[model samples]
Target: MTRRFLFAPLIAVALFAACRPSPEPGAGGITQVATIDALLAGAYDGTVTLAELRRFGDFGIGTFHALDGEMILLDGVFYKVRGDGSVGEPPQSETTPFASVTHFRADVREELPAGLDLPALEARIDRLLPQANRFCAFRVRGEFRHVRVRSVPAQSKPYRPLVAVTRNQPMFTLQGVRGTLVGFRSPSFVKGVNVPGYHLHFLADDRRSGGHVLEFTAATSTLEADTLHDFLTIRLPAPGAAFEKVDLTPDRSGELEEAEKNPAVRD
Candidate 1:
């Protein structure tokens, strides 16, 4: 009886193995089934929900303007949307309020008139190339969210906004020095102007060789649009260091002056 039972289990295992299909190979000995989106999504540790994507789309189109809000995630990292209409690094905090707009009407695909083409735009990300030798290459992926336009504000003279990019991810360098956060600003953008081209900001650590935490912050004018039909780029600084936090209250300048006078304060 025991022998018969053992034989029955062995037969079942053999039958299962025989029914399994072999994986097919593709060009260059690499599998071709993985899609660009899948490849992009796989780079992160978490999944990006549809609701979050919609909010991202709203922010991209300038429909969902928030003075202070948390960063949205596509996959696991914080994806920044600047005032000028560009995407930035993933956020470090899930609850931190970063300024953003929520209404965009442009398509973020290649060859789109809005100029936010993902593939083409990604190819233009040159700021980080210099650091490639220092750190391992990681895939940064995202998609555009489609949002309904509610209103459009009157066009103002175009100007550049101060943009800051911060490293929200921690990494250990080959040399073992800790990563430091850096920030920089863009040229400028007009108050109510809409431009055809999109600006972007990339974030990374100082590449010191140790593990370090980085964050991103941008202070720009609130998008003043009633209906949201216009497509605008979420402008961010090009590859640069992170920025220091500034008071967002109406008396921000006064606070800065006070801080400057304090001996403990450092620029």
Candidate 2:
């Protein structure tokens, strides 16, 4: 079975790292398919085809229609990290309900230190890319000492909020794996529009396993930060009952925190 390799979460404390950067303020635009609020509200059906999404940018992160799997768009290729912890290249015909993409071009490059965990890495990078008000898309490639990631199962109709769906999300643990972490650092003002902090997805070099990266410690890696200085486009989903009828007025940052940061609340 494709789900054969799923593993329990592994706990490990991580350390801080340092970086050197020379920013190239602008190059590509950031195109997002739908707002994060919509996804958190259980509007899982997608309207934007990956084929069309390619027109906007090449590298980014998001999920598939029906919330089927985690998405990793690297070097113009779209890869799906399934709930089973297996990786596959989904067809361009498939649509994404929520996604963020950019024609990734490295503006600053740095070699990160060993044993740096997610928080530490984010902290280090934050210092280097101090433009907290601007969007930053990064690609971190290297060998990982340990990686913990998760992906929720495909949701059926009459969908529950994302927090509800991920309560029993499948978690995976990978050690001694080589991969690339793809994600973005959005401004705090983008809370409803996108993740306020960092939202990252990982894909192993073999492209055989990956998911929404929960935590990790890098053994060795290189960082590419693209400080986006171009325009930002937020595309609305096609008019449909799922998106149109859903209530998005409430503040769900608390909900989003649990959904994005917390691991499976239940087995």
lDDT of 2 by residue, 1-267 (tens): 434434322111112111322132113778898789989999999889998887778898999999999999999899999989988899999999999998888989999999888988899889999999999999899999988999877889888899898888999999999999998999999989899999999999999989998899999999999998877888887765477887889999988988998453312
Misplaced by over 4 Å in model 1 are 1-93, 107-267
TM-score of each: 0.20, 0.87
lDDT of 1: 0.24
Candidate 2 lDDT score relative to the true structure: 0.87
Clashing pairs in 2: none
Cα lDDT, all candidates: 0.24, 0.87
Model number with the top lDDT: 2
Candidate 1 lDDT score at position 45: 16
Instruction: Kindly list the per-residue Cα lDDT of model 1 for residues 1-267, writing each as its tens digit.
Output: 999998998999989876874332111111111111211111111222223334433232111112111133222234433333233453333222122233322222122223232233323322323222111112222212211101111112221111111111112112211211111111123112221122222222331111111111211111111222223333221233111122222222332222112122324
